[model samples]
Target: MAFRAYGEVQQRTAGPKEIELSLFRQITEALEAVAAVETPPLEAWADALYRNQQLWTIVATDLVNPDNTLPEETKRNLVSLSQFVRQCSNRVLAGNDGIADLIDINKSIIAGLSGIPVSTVTEEAA
Candidate 1:
């Protein structure tokens, strides 16, 4: 009951962008946690990667929607990024250790959504 109430309150209070940022943060955290495990169980790794892939896929789809308000260039860039995410995830699932790049991408997106300049986030990461 308490959990349901909290969720209702949160939904009412958080705007769309805030909710998107929060979801990205949560999915990124899951990916990070799995990556931190030195030899994470296959199931755990797959679950994290799957979640991130799903998130990006949804974002890409939404970007192309006719009702989406984003500029064409921005939508194209994001859709391209989402494609990269999907390809990288495929590589990772095929035994390549490429999860770090995906995590960094998610972090960059989170930073952008949080109103921080992406270049600043990239420089900080470097």
Candidate 2:
């Protein structure tokens, strides 16, 4: 059974890996789109970053199935991403820092999800 331990969710429901992978793909695609576009609008980029946070949080919360085993790193990313997204919301959106930050966070998130290392995602960023 999925249970919250020490304020961190822990459990990997059936097919959670698949859902995580799909979410990662979405993030990657968004980054690619932002990269390919010629000077994508600040609003568009900021919006993309915000949406990226939405996607990551949904996955962390288990979009496809119950996910109980979210690592400490995942939890931290989830929180940070949420905050960054919230900060980006309804703003003038005049630069690409938001987008760049989102991209970096996404890469680190995927690395953590891939079992590379959880703390690696949050170390430098935080």
Best candidate (score: lDDT): 1
lDDT of 2 by residue, 1-126 (tens): 234562233234437665666577576667658766878776766566666757755754552344556566756667666666545543325553435555565666677667777467546444
Each candidate's clash count: 0, 4
lDDT of each: 0.89, 0.59
Candidate 1 regions exceeding 4 Å error are 119-126
Estimate candidate 2's RMSD in Å. Answer: 10.4
Tens digits of per-residue lDDT for model 1, 31-76: 8888778888888888899889989988998998999999999999
TM-score against truth, every candidate: 0.89, 0.52
Backbone clash pairs for candidate 1 read none
Backbone clash pairs for candidate 2 read 10-68, 10-69, 11-68, 11-69
- Which stretch of 10 consecutive residues in model 2 shows the poorest summed lDDT? 5-14
